[model samples]
Target: MSTLAPPRPSPRTTASAGLRGPARLVVRQHRRAFQLLILLTALTAAGLVAVALWAGHDADVFARTGCRVDTVTTDACTRSTRAYDDSQYRLNHSLSVVALLTAVLSAAYGAFMAGPALARELESGTHRLAWTQSVSPARWLTAKLAVPAALTVACTLVLTTVCTWFSTRGTLHPLYWHDTSVYGTTGVYPFAQALCGLALGTLAGLLLRRAFAAMALAAAAQGIAVHVLQNVRGHLWPVVHGPYALARSNPFPRDAWMTEVGYLTGTGERLPMGTCFPIRGKFGDCLDSLGVTRRYADYHPKSHYWPLQLVESGILLAVAALAVYAAHRLLRRLHA
Candidate 1:
């Protein structure tokens, strides 16, 4: 008896079969997370565009009113400055909120990575089934991390680029280059921070293997990282010390980060500016009485902005690398 040859698989079926691996499984399992990531990216892009357009409109108004001239006392100048400052305040506030939201979402992503993506599978014994199939445990973990890591980095880079563009606009209202929120969002720092979060989450997942515990630990780790980094950010670059008069022209170059201003004693010691507090008579007289020979400041010049950002980014990336390495080692040990 001649058995009918089995029908050949269709091209679509063949293609789907070829895709039946760890990578596709990871995508299918976390499809909702990926969908949310796309939505978040679109919203962030739209918000940034809206802010840019609004700032551009305000800038146009400032230009039409001829408020570019340096005038501190004219009624027109005062009105113009007020309008400009108001617009700036709104822009900065909005940007700050967006930056904060980005940070929060990044941290939440870390927690999700730990809880839902990794630990849940381990907890439910689903990972064992995946391992027994065509996927090895290491490959399964790699696929899980590779997808989210790629998406996170791509989205963060886009957001950072948009933020950098917003920062370059010459609106009457200017954001300080050293402002924490501004700096965090406008450079490579955001990308590093997001990657760090992802690595920390993965490590947490491997360690705890319990969804809630991993999520909580990952979130806490992210919070501690942000707090510590913020506290030490000023020291990431060398501080330039100089006569404070250099600051008097504009308090600082528009882009310089003025960290501290103080009195320089005749003996060459630095005293808090508070020593000259409550300037009563001549400011110099008050300083002389305090044995101050000159005014001084500790600052990071505008030129140091990139250096500072690079330093911070490097530190964060190093931490992320360590976390990832530790996760890999832990996985190997567990499976050994």
Candidate 2:
């Protein structure tokens, strides 16, 4: 059990002397998969850049024809915009699909961790080859994690930056910002989510030690975690409460992600606007009749984006750390 815990000097040793063999071993073992990972990253980044440039060119061409994307349709504007509109529609649809794919990337990472990174080695008894060598379990696990973690982090960082830049640059496009897909694809959260998935899946594999079962457990558990996080996301941050002025309220700043809209009482209790249904009187009269002290709009302004992202990333990273610690402890116990 003591040997399961790396020596105090192991960190420096591992960084310099210990890792060279194991890291190369792990990469060689997964050479095809590793190569595929690199190839996909390069292709995806290049393709996204090309698409953005092409879309920008199309938009500029449409603008040259004297049309605006947001304005009411005139005959000439309508005729000219048909091609541009089609292209934009397809692009937005693709964006949504890509976002959905990005959200599930964590699940894929988890599955890979369980199925290949740990379980396959264990099931095939190949891990013993490393453990039987100068490599300790800690170093073996570190080698396994470090390579994939680096690749996953770099992959998400590049994709997120590209997607965010493209999405924000286009004024005619709407912010899908509040959507889980959009949020998943555009920030630090995606990589954090992937890291958490890897850790949790590695832990699961360490526990189960069977390839298929561990893969299923890891994928399902991580997927559910991501879904739950998205569902409870609105509560993660304190929402900005509204101008009691409602319609006349200074109006939410552009791109604010509104979470709730309703009326409030003097006690600050919320009531839906429908609660004041009027048979004949105006909406204002109905509100007055109900003693509605003020209207409420619970929202997250655009400024909250980074704050929310950072907070969520913090949570995911914390969980990842715990999972890795548990994996470390479990591996020690198993090898003891």
Candidate 3:
């Protein structure tokens, strides 16, 4: 009798050969979702790069005319200048929107975690079967969160790095770095937002055990968290202030985030923007009557971008950690 050699794993199994135990099992269940996620992400990132390259070519064509790209003065400028500016605007706007969509999807990972990942199992009692097969509640929960979280971070990293690179190197337009949609997608901050969504979704699923309800709750919560963070981000770091003399002038760079613009009182107190608006009589007389000394402006300079990103990311991560802990405790109470 011929001796049989060891069997070879199938190609599908071989591709995922390294994954074992709960990790592999989780992947098997959500393979379709993962496939769809990766496909969409790849297409979006490709579009971003393509747009950037097209913009670069347009910029070069416009510059060759020896026309000042910034000012539209009639210097025998060809129609190419207007066309170039229009193209740049469209491309940059597309870049911002697509990158923002990717970030939003990362945050929507919570809905997956809340519905199909956790609540589905709990609602249908599938988790009980896993628990009987040498898997505790904690192990089961970890498997659900860890695999998806890893995928979220991986997808986010690729898209964000591409966006950041395009924003810095590819964009020749006058787009500001701190545009809300653009900022939300560009750094470690989006990664933090993803984690926060995942944890909150987990918590919601654990509490509700109903897929639809849990998903809705998690998504709404994530949206609120994102909005709250974005709203408060400027205040996270002290802004660079412009002197009263520069009030009527923008001393900050064109790309800086202007947090405030107003007038300064003689006693050095800041006044609102319309302090002398509608200019009754002489502008100087109105200023003198109101004790307005000069103009005041507050802005976060370009250099402060990274610091703002880092600080907000830290705060979000802390919130995510607490949410995870609370989820674990609740699961333990329910099971034990």
Model 2 residue runs over 4 Å out of place are: 1-15, 69-76, 176-181, 246-250, 277-286
Query: Can you write out model 3's per-residue Cα lDDT over 1-336, one digit (the tens) per residue?
Result: 999998988977854443356787899999999988889889888988888888888888877877876666774674777778777887778777875695578557999999999999899998887778666788778888899899989988888888887776434465567886568778788899888899999999999999999999999988888788878888999998887573355656788888898888879988788767788678778788888877877898889989999999999889899999999999989998
Error of 1 at 166 (Å): 1.4
Model 1 C-alpha lDDT per residue in residues 212-266, reported as the tens digit of each score: 9999999999989988988888888889887754225445566777788777777
Which pairs of residues have clashing backbones in candidate 3? 247-295
Worst 10 residues of 2 by lDDT: 167-176
Q: Candidate 2's C-alpha lDDT?
A: 0.80
Clashing pairs in 2: none
Cα RMSD for candidates in order:
4.5, 6.2, 4.7
C-alpha displacement of 68 in model 1, angstroms? 8.2
> Which segments of candidate 3 are over 4 A away from where they belong?
1-19, 67-78, 169-172, 246-248
Q: Which 10 residues in a row give candidate 3 its minimum summed lDDT? A: 14-23
TM value for model 2: 0.88
Of the two candidates 1 and 2, the one with more favorable TM-score, higher being better, is 2
